[model samples]
Target: MNNGVNVTALAVFVLFFLLVTVMGFMASRWRKADNALHLDEWGLGGRSFGTWVTWFLLGGDLYTAYTFVAVPAAVYATGAAGFFAVPYTIIAYPLVFLFLPRLWSVSRVHGYVTPADFVRGRYGSKALSLVVALTGILATMPYIALQLVGIQAVLDVLGVGGGAGSNWFVKDLPLFIAFGVLAAYTYSSGLRAPALIAFVKDALIYIVIIVAVIYIPMRLGGYGHIFDTAAQKFSTPKSPGSLILAENKQWTYATLALGSALALFMYPHSVTGVLASKSRNTVRRNMAIMPAYSLMLGLLALLGFMAIAAGVGSGVKGFNAQLSVPQLFENMFPDWFTGVAFAAIGIGALVPAAIMSIAAANLFTRNVYKEFIRPDATAADETRVAKLASLLVKVGALAFVLTMDKQAAINLQLLGGLWILQTFVSIVGGLFTRWFHHWALFAGWAAGMVYGTYQAYGIASPATKHFGGSAANIPVIGEIGYIGLTAFVLNLAVAVVLTLVLRALKAPVGTDETDPDDYGAEAGDPKTQNAPVPAAAH
Candidate 1:
């Protein structure tokens, strides 16, 4: 069968795309800077976002199009296990409420642009900062690719994944156009573009999910039937799993949920959102209330079951389970509403993609380029390099999109979570205490990253054949759990043991630039507020 684009959905998707493009360009003016070329102003939107704006910015940053597409796809594919994101987000926020505030205080004090910047100052180790910076960028690359996967899922559902008469050019043209707009605005407006566009993205998503939650269940006979139908599908020989956590796999669920919750805030984009807030209060307020998105996620997860009941993506050609939610929207909704839902997914991808790029760029500029390449770079020079770096970051992520599989979002994102979680010991651990030696932290991170990558690479499955899975059977842990979490435990143990050994040897732990007062410092606390970046920080 020849694939053909749905004209109405395409039109609506383009319409919303144009709307955000305009807003993206216009956002450069939102917090009018005398010279927006300064990193503080351009890279972080002048740090002027109030409570509500921070709410939307963080919301948009935390949840991406992948969450919309992949989470449902997971549920659609694996029954109960897909709901791991809900518990992850729920557990993540409380942790953020406690830890992020101090990071924010220190960041605001030193005018830090990335988490690595804070690490550079707190530990006074360029190598340590470089590790954090590289991890942030590497983990983020796959994440941004997953956003494209989200876009591809929508395009596939609309019959635009290279239709029979259309070549690959025609199939991917819309995605390119959307990305071009995103890259342009992100370069011109920096953080403001995504910050402003996030409001629209969140609203459209809320509307779509609210509609899908209420309308789809009614259309599918009812919620009970939807669950029954899904449960029946899983029981068949072709697909075997329980709708609740399986007995032996219970630990898998527990570890995955815990590990993911720990990893969530460590992503650079999440930190970028928090740092962009106008004040510490803004960060605190947003954390407490941000569980609202978690609630939406629960409703969104239901759509996976709804898709199963509707027989969406059952045996469709070129269809992956990731397209399940898009297929459900396309199959069940009217053309116009389907367009709105598609736009939500498209806009959703753009918002996070832009932020992830900006955050990556900031890391390159602050921790890599300025630190090593040109220590004399002024804020303007740093900002210019960051802007160009942002464009490059997007291009790299686009490569992953063009070359990777449909399930790349799931596998790569899982890898991203695992790889990034290694930094938790350095960034989060350093935030609370300074006892861990820099060498010890770096060594621990190295051990975890190497083990996690090797383990994930060895697990084989039908989808990937190699590097095919994120879970494994382990000693002591009878159930299969996330390899990342297990590696993290190793990472922590190694760091603790090494720290004690290194300290006993009287080895240098690097200079601690942060004063205890810095953690508790507020906006008006001059000692921390004007804390200077030391000469050796980089």
Candidate 2:
């Protein structure tokens, strides 16, 4: 019930903050490249990450700040249904396993930096590439902001409370300090910083989870009792339903998970991480080994129930249920362990925020600035622009926290998820075949983005009671929804129909820019330098 900061806990937090700061700058030399000056070396970490490196990098990239906070928060507020994150993680690797290799080979063969770069070359449409790039940058800003939110969440738990009244610096100084550290390292070390620091990030997360999962349960009672208590607490007679979902939500869960898996790799950060891998085997092994993180996630989700059983909100009145985990640890453990838990959350926020900002910046540089604004921009110029852009992305994310509702920021993330998913058809589908025309694909992307954004804006949840709720909508025939999946359907439909229309008009179908055989090729593969490397590790 104590609300004051624990000085011992604060010291442990300070130690982690300093450690990651050192790790970030030191990462520049970890995977020494022929030349760090090259765009490939700086932007993509030399395109030379080995299997273990890629494993940690991709795990760090995909399992993000939201995974650490929102998933567990969802479990605390709801019940078993919040476990949707687990299935999504399970399905994503296998689903991406099918298409990512093809993407890697094509990108490597063509020297493509962004998926938009691939679309531009393959379908020969600057306009289409612009759309993809813009979508990526737009979707990514809120994502980057959410990472800040993750950092804020952890900092909030650590008792790094805001200053008096609306004082700007006091309220935001912690955020500024965290992001400044992140931006500086990302600017200096590029992808290598996150690639290397991911090792530390993942290790700490594992340690935290293992300790909390075992110790928290033993201290409280047991898993069954915890869940049983949570079920009782959250159960509602007004709805005449258990806290968990019925059969209907299960279908929605499965569909959303499947849709999310397809969307997962389409996000530019996911591609940026994958492209950093040294070989196909690295990517494959990353996918194969990354599931271990999911085990941690399953445990993390249970913290919600543990929070309930510990009577996290029992003593207090009107305490934010989202603060359940923080309270749980504070009450059960001494100040020292509490600090470690807070450090885990804080560091977790920084690593992915750094990666997401870098990824978004690279997309803007490669696909937007170089492609559109300065076709002849030098590597140094590109790097400088990226560094500046990364800062702006972080600042923009901070603006989200300041200007918008914190709860609204959460919904914006789901909207980002939906928008990014639409790119799947062009990015992943095109990897296997160039059958879809540039114009067709462009049309598909446009339609999907608009529809998805609109639908997301219209969605009203019971809690928020406004826009942004469930991903699926109840339909007449077979609960057919999942905005990402729906947008994808619209995207494919537009692509297919337009392909036929464009063909009938005998319009020039842009050259088949990528060779399919190159999907299986590697460094020795012919014609590799002209395009960006596709899913290289797996």
Winner by lDDT: 1
lDDT of 1 at 238: 73
Poorly placed runs, candidate 1 (over 4 Å): 315-318, 528-538
* Estimated TM-score for each candidate: 0.96, 0.94
Compared with the true structure, what per-residue lDDT tens digits does model 2 show for residues 1-538?
A: 5545678988998898889899999988787765565567778898888888888888888777668777777787767667888888888888888877767777777777778878787777788788888889888888888888877766666667653464877867788888788888888898999888888888888887899999989987788888788778766564323466777677767777777777788888899988877777777778888889888889999888888788877757556656777667777778888888777777777777888888888889988899889998877677778888888988888888878877788787777878888777877767777777888888898898888877777777655755556465634445746777778888899999999898888888777676667788766555655454222221
Point to the candidate with the largest TM-score: 1
- Provide the RMSD of all predictions against the true structure, rounded to 1 decimal: 2.6, 3.3
Local lDDT at 390 for model 2? 85
Backbone clash total, candidate 1: 0
